[model samples]
Target: MSDQGSSTSTSQTDGDFEGELDEEVESEEGVKEKGRDSPTPSLSNFSASLRAVIRIKQKYQAMKKRRQEMVLGLGAGALVGAPGRTSPKIFTFDGLTPSAFPTLSSIQQKKKKRRRKRVLFPTGGGRKAMPRQERSRATYCLYLLLAILFLQVYNAIENLDDHVLRYDLEGLDKMLRREVFGQQGAVDGLLSHLKDYLSTYVHNKPLVVSLHGPSGVGKSHLGRLLAGHFRSVVGETLVLQYYVLHHCPQEANALECARNLSSHISEMVERAEEEEKIPLFIFDEAEHMHKEILDELWQLVASKQSNEYLNTIYLFLSNLGHGHITKHMLHNSSSISMAMTASGRHSNLLKELTPILRNTLEKLHPLWTEADILPLSLLEKRHVMECFLDEMTREGFYPDHTNIERLAGEIDYYPGAEGREYSQTGCKQVVAKVNLL
Candidate 1:
């Protein structure tokens, strides 16, 4: 019974050991399968994470590129649209649209429209009338200024004429008419020349008057009168009465006379220029003057000399044309009387005689060509009688017409036309005859 129990126990123990070995093998296989499956799942998860990161980077790059394109588009639009109206087309960047920038012209037009509306509709209510344009004080002031300027100009012009009148020319005219006799035409011519010259202070050349007639026809008297008048008006220093016989009698003194004459003229003219005055130079018995003296006078008055000589008056009293004057008076005594009454006829008569006188004096010297010739006709009997009466009155003698006639009759007379007698030597001996009284 003990042996059978031992055998069963041994078998049971071996079965138990086999079962434990099978269970260990199964646990090792399960562990190997778990390791292989774990490796595959970890590798797959790593690949998926890498792909997601790459996609995210690509999306960020696309967004940055779109932003750059939008910036470029905005810059281009602003540059292109600056000079003209803003484009009507919409500008888009990555499907985004912004409002258009307003242009300068559009803003100005809107402002103008607002202004027009404000003008059409007054804030007070109804439209107001247009404002009247009142004249400003400035306009009247401008007119007043123009009027004052015009008045000033007019006054200045009047003053220029008044300046000429200041020389007492009317007084000179009256004196000539009162004192000088029987040479109405000559006096007229002389007065006219004086008026024309003295009217202006400016002169281009000296005035030269050549008086031609007989010795006793009042040429020297006229010279004396002119010298006296000018001496009173201008001054004694500015009046030079030169006589060939008195100043230079001898032929040997001709050169010295000429030098003296030139120096005197130069000094006189210079002084007169300083004083702004015109000088008078009278040459009595100019026909008897030497060629050198005449030439000196001519040089002083020549246009090429100097401006100081321009404002001077020179009188040349000569008996060179006395023959022609006598002949003319004898032939035209009746016409001359008529001329004395009519100014036109007197001028015509002077016109006819001037050329003849000029031609006659030109034979003696060429200096007469530059001179304005004035011829004194032979005095009538009545004129000589009047001269005698004037001298007697000047000498404080009784007023006796019969004695004047008797004295005038003593002078030689030339038989003239229409019972008119002309004195051969006009008023020559009247002074002597009066002194005898």
Candidate 2:
């Protein structure tokens, strides 16, 4: 009975230990359930939850801000007004809110605001930047002005035809008529032929003419006139004139004159032909030079064998055949008259006198007289009076015809010359007489 009581007590102790363990376990379960249901949790657990939420919110805010910054950077990079941009875009920030994320237009506006406040100098200046369009236009205009200046410099260097300050062809002819008297037909013939000759040197033949007439005539005057009028046709140093009386030293005989002439002619011809220019040689007083000079002269004209001299124009003036010329004019005295436009007896004079003059020249110098015979006729009373009146007009003064005739009476002429009483000295003394008047 003692053993059974001992066993029963042991069983009751085990039951009690089990029952306490179960109550403890049940209490722990109830506390866990209460903590899960209650608003106030453990301090450490509440703090851990709060830290996790704060970390997540910070990550999300950082991501959003980064995305906004990327958009702003993109907008700024895309649009800046610069030259050579084909497609232009304008950005605006009208209704954008400040707190909102930065948009493309708003970011662009911010960039522009910063730029406006920024310095501009060599970067920009004391004033606002000059507009890009205005700057570009100014650059282009400056370039154009430089180009024009360069072109002007080139033209000035070339110096084409403007070297001749005066180009007056017709004015020359009128002046010739005013200065010379009683030879309009001869002067007109010279002008017509010279125009054709000078322009086309290689086309036909050069003009070779000999002035055959009386003394005190205008042969030397005409030669000088030609040289002065066409001054621009050649270089200033190209004119060559030979007066027989002015040949080297008074002792130079015909042979010396011939030698000097041929040598000088050859050199001048070479220069003129090489440069493709027309040179003028006026040989005056063939009658005075020895027969040998005449022969050299004839060879120069007739054969023209010197290729160098082919382009030169030769004018030989002399009183060689005036005796025949005077007889012919006196023979045609009844028909002789002077008109401004009419060739009159002067036109027929060449045909009749050419044969006579050619025969005389041919006999005198062993050469074929291949030349244009220009006979300068005698000055009539009317021509003299007109010349006097024109001279007074040129001197800025005027005089009546009565005074001119009275002054002209101081001159003398042969009486039996078929009423053709041209003065013994022709018009040579008239100038002296006018000075006295």
Candidate 3:
């Protein structure tokens, strides 16, 4: 039994050893198979791929930078050339090829064919159908013409110096005081009107701007400023001459006077459109204009009549008192009645009068009276004086306190026709004299 057991154990040991040997062989085979399947890249091939990627990146960057340079250069050149160039075409060498020459030849041949079809002198085969050489020449010629046009336009814009700067809302307080120094009533009324006008303008309403009061109240100055502002927005025109009835010859009848003024106004309107592109009309010293002139002026101001011709933002500087505007319209004259009715306001005087005029002016219920006047009291005049004095000092036009007081006193004592003085003494004339001085 012992011998049998030993023999069996020896047999089992042999089987175990065989199994171990088989397992070792299988593991070795698997390792060899993996080694065969995986191959390593060569240094040369790896380097070549890396170089290719870098080159692509570099190429992209170069192209991006080139595009930027081209755009910037072209824009700069265009801006620099705009002043001297008229034609829209630009001279450039980009995108040219040998094949382009052949295309140009073909274009020339086509143009020749077209010319053969048309016999007119320099009229046939318009610009589009022209030969390549002719087209190039024409383009260059157009450029020259455009250059001339640009030069002319520049000159015209540069020469428009007919504008005068007036006090804007930013400086109104100072301006009012300067004009109405001692006359609080006048200053109050004028400043209020100016404020109203500015407000209306800000609201984009159609304004019939009229400055009406006694003579020497700086109406013309205000009118000119308002006109300049209008011109700045719409355009500008130079009034070379403004001839009144008194300035004309003895033979110039009222009809002739009207015709002459109309002709001047028409020309001015046309020039404003053509040259200055201005749409506003300003009439300074409108009160001094004759009845004939007033009739024509009214026509111009009436939006329905000459608006097409005038394109006017109308401003009338008048010495005609606010009372006349209200009272004169009620007289029942046909012309006055028609003008008042069509004036776009209850009264003809309200047509282009200052917005303050509405509040300051008392309604001339039966006829004109002191009650109907919107008086600028003494306090208002003093305020206005301070405003003007402040502005003048800021503008480097300094005056002594005594001088300012003297000026104010003058406004308190001015004389006028019909025993009608300045709403405050010396206010109007003193301001004018100071400005003149």
Task: Please name the candidate that would achieve the greatest lDDT relative to the true structure.
Answer: 1
Residue lDDT tens for model 1, 1-437: 22333335445644654565456456545544664677554665556546645654565466556545554554455556354324423344543444466778899999999987774435697768785699999999999999999999889768657755766677777887778778877888888888888877888988999988887889998999889888887899999999889999999999999998899889999999999888999999988899998787767766486777888899998898688777776787676554246345457667888888777777877777778888777777888888887777788888787887788889988864667887877888888878887
| Candidate that scores best on TM-score | 1
Candidate 1, RMSD to the unseen true structure:
22.6
- Could you tell which candidate, 2 or 3, scores higher by TM-score? 2
Ranking by lDDT: 1, 2, 3
lDDT of 3 by residue, 194-312 (tens): 44543321223223444455543455555554455444444446432243534543444766777777777778767755653434555565545555665665555543544335333
At residue 190, candidate 3 shows an lDDT of 45
TM-scores of the models, in the given order? 0.66, 0.56, 0.36
**TM-score (C-alpha) between model 2 and the true structure:** 0.56
lDDT of each: 0.77, 0.67, 0.48
Error of 1 at 111 (Å): 11
Model 2: lDDT equals 0.67
**Model 1, stretches more than 4 Å misplaced?**
1-166, 336-345
lDDT of 2 by residue, 267-297 (tens): 8778878876677777777567677787787
Q: So what's the TM-score on candidate 1?
A: 0.66
Off by over 4 Å in 3: 1-207, 230-253, 274-276, 301-307, 322-384, 387-398, 410-426, 431-437
In model 1, how large is the Cα lDDT of residue 253? Answer: 95
